[model samples]
Target: MGLIVTIIIGFFVGLIAKFLMPGRDPGGFIITILLGIGGALTANFLGRALGLYSTNEAAGFIASVIGAMILLAIYRAFSGRGRLTH
Candidate 1:
């Protein structure tokens, strides 16, 4: 139940990140879901570590979206598909 909720939220986060970034991505639906989940988890953990969020709190929507965007950028950079061609 909790996992499902997380996945759904993550999907939306990932979608928003992709929409904002507006570029070619390495993967599709499954990748998006993974990216979102990863982003949310990363934000949650990093925030807690940095004292931005309490241990009991999860990452907010905006933070999650930002995290996803960062992850997407990293992914693009590593995959060597981030270059623009004319």
Candidate 2:
């Protein structure tokens, strides 16, 4: 039950992140889902460490999206150099 909810939320989070940072991203739905989940985890961890969020309060959707965007930026930075646009 919890897992299903996570997946569903992850999907939407991924979509929102992609919409905000439009570009030629690699992979499809699966990747997007992973990105979303990763983003949420990242935000949760970082926020907790920084005292911005409590254990009872997981990172919200906005933070998740922001985290996804950050990951996307890093992905592009590393992968962009290896690919030829032309």
Instruction: Work out the TM-score per prediction.
Output: 0.87, 0.87
lDDT tens readout by residue for model 2, 6-84: 9988888888988998888987989999999999998998899999998898999999998888888889889884355
lDDT of 1: 0.88
**Model 2 misplaced regions, further than 4 Å:** 81-86
Alpha carbon RMSD to native, model 1: 1.4
lDDT of 1 by residue, 1-86 (tens): 99899889988999999999998886788889999998888888888889999878989999999889888888888987788767
TM-score of model number 2: 0.87
* Clashes per candidate, residues 3 or more apart or on different chains: 0, 0
Q: Cα miss at 44, model 1 (Å)?
A: 1.1
lDDT of model 1, residue 41: 83
lDDT of 2: 0.88
Cα error, candidate 1, residue 58 (Å): 0.8
